[model samples]
Target: MAEEALFAGPAIRRLRKREGLTQAAIAARLEISPSYLNLIERNQRPISARVVMRLVEQFDFDPRTLREDEAIGGVEGLVRRFADERFADLGIDREEMQELLSAAPQAAAAFARLYDNAAPASLAADDPFAASRREIERWRNHFADLDVAAEELADEMRLSRGDMGLALVDRLRERHQLSVRILPQEVMPDSLRRLDLHARQVQLSEMLSAASRNFQLALLIAQLEQRDQIDAIAKGARFEDEAARGFFTRHLMGYFAGALIMPYGRFLRACEATGYDLPVLLRRFGVSFEQLAHRLTTLQRVGQRGLPFFMVRVDRAGQFSKTFVGASTARFVNSDVSCPLWHVHRAFERAGELQVQFVSLDVAGEREGGWLTMARTVEGRGEPGETQFVVAIGVEAVLAGELAQARGISLRSDDAQPIGPGCANCHRVRCSQRSLPPRGRKLHFDTIRRGVTPFELASS
Candidate 1:
């Protein structure tokens, strides 16, 4: 069988334009003729493996960008966007979507942004969190400046040498001239950590676990020390309002806190050395599983990058409480509704125990790729009673060989369960777990025989 061609014309053209290189200059660098390069840029000719390697070697380009560009403002994204009922009447097809992405990717991105802004008032109103998520996604949840600042502070305090919590508390006291006070739950019923600027004290509720206390301390330090940097980064985002900017700023502070507690260089080395053993990492960091999983998502530091892990925290009802997409191109990572078949939902059933699964995400009945996912339940900090959440982390299947958790798991194994973004966007008509039909697909009634699903989609 002939190998499928890789036609990444738009991506190559964008790269060339970004680098201010003409077709002839880029062709010279890639050892290809200007006419051939032009053909490739116009997508008239398929990009060869040799050219791909040359591009990677010459410009330090990520190979995935050539293939997975569709995940971000590409054809697949347009497909999902136009799948909405609002666009059903337009009847846009896949080929048209692909052409739009290929010819005018910037315009396509702007259209996607316009579509988002055109959402119903009920869903869009007072929803700064969505804007915050977009900003984080734009950065791929990695902030080098914040990580460097946090790592410097961590080293200065020698956090890894002794009790991390004690180190943070001492640093706060000595550096900021603030006293640390652990108040009883009755005294501070609602808040977890409160900074009393007037009293020059940082008060923490007794109900908080040791790990929580440490995290809170680190977060405070981030706010005090990294406020200027965080504000500047948040201001760079195209936030709709101050609420969105504030929400993004708070998330950045948390990112800084996570970095402080688990410095990037140290954490990446530990992760690689331990083969990403979660239990071992949890013990070493003195942090909760959720916190560790979240930290794993920020391991994308260019030259010393770790696995491109994606993290998501979902409640029992399947609502995403928090999510960070490091480098994985999996659309389901940011989907509003996740597939029911994913182990993320099943993790609730086996609380505290890690549930691992190899899942294949499908789009429009076509397989996108495989992923190795792990999920476990974590207790949430809610008022009155503690709420439970499932925190899940996943890396692409190709990188699973590097993880200790993926031992004994074969990527080629047929046991890999097929999943989708969710019932709404998924066109897997035969999925037994599908709760609803796909958004744009019409239902076909089969009175004679019932299929795997209750409703069958018509083959248009």
Candidate 2:
């Protein structure tokens, strides 16, 4: 097979700037003349296989770094925004999109940003709760260094789930002078767990199950013991404000709690042995369904990787509360709420049952690839009127054959149910469940020409 020519001039230039290297310096390292290197930087010539190998061996740069992963992300964002009917005049095919990403990446990104500023407000536009949720979703629900630190700490502890919970309680009492107490639901009111630093007490509601009690205990320990680590991670995040930083820290505390409950190496092995079986893993690890789902997404450790899964949590009213898309899959952006046709919405009608579906990711959806999805409703322990939430997790379609949930899913079938990212961005012509016309399209009221759907978008 012939070698594919590499035209990643922009990527190379960016790397050169990052490393403070001159064109002559990079050329000397690649064993090429300075003039030839200049031509490559201008994208006038494709990089040879020999030079690509030298760059990899000499500079320790990721192959993907040169492949323009950042540029691809921007291009994808543009593609989604451009799919809207309003952008019909600026039509470009997939090949042209590639050229734009390769030769004019900065221009492509500028266009994506411009479209974002010009796009109409989504459903969550003015809602404060939705705003907070979007901030959490922005992190993609996983932090590599935080996970690594938690894993190292867990390894040192070397305790089972039960023992780990006991250890946390002891550490709080002995080290922080904080005592654990289980209080009646009426006394605690709406709170499941509350920490009274002034009173030196950490209270847990009696309504919580054994697993939940353990989780709450672990979370309290994280807040007290892992405060420094959490703060450090938040500092590195460079959040826009103190409030966002606090939210990020709280999320990291939860991550530490989950990692404590299910240690990385052990949890990964269990995932493989069980074939990613949710119930069995839940029993073995003594964690809630939601905890297990969240933990599943963090098995991103180098060689001991588990299946890449994207997880989302939503309420009965169709508001997305939390989401995490794995690295291997296409990123989901803009709004966390999925298309109306997704099974996550259906989970609200049938509470407490696992709903599985095979879905195709198209122009209408936020994510860029196919998925094998599983969703289920979970009731939270709260006051009488408190709402329950549904948690849905999806893996790339290619991994379906190995998944226990995908046993009878027919991974090869092309009969996947069509779903968009959301109504605001979806442009599928025959979708009966569309809530609104796509942002860029003009609504046509053709009394003379009736179509299958309510609105027929004019072709570009």
Q: 1-460, model 2: which lDDT tens digit per residue?
A: 1223456688678778888999999889889999998888888997865675566556745333443433234445556556777768877776787677777776776776666656444543545444444555455455666677667767766657557667767767887898989998789878888888899999998888778888888787787678887887677764445666666677788989898888887898888898899888888988878898888876655545566677888887666777765443534423545787889888888877789998865553333345688898876776532439989888756555677887777754355666776777665666778777876665778779877677777654
Error (Å) of candidate 2 at residue 67 is 13
In order, what lDDT does every prediction score? 0.80, 0.70
Measured by TM-score, the strongest candidate is: 1
TM-score of each: 0.80, 0.74
Clash count, predicted structure 1:
0
Q: Which residue ranges in model 1 land beyond 4 Å of their true spot?
A: 1-126, 382-387
**Worst lDDT window (10 residues) for model 1?**
67-76
TM-score (C-alpha, index-matched) for candidate 2: 0.74
Q: Residue 29: error of model 2 in Å?
A: 23
Clashing pairs in 1: none
Return the lDDT, model 2, position 338: 73
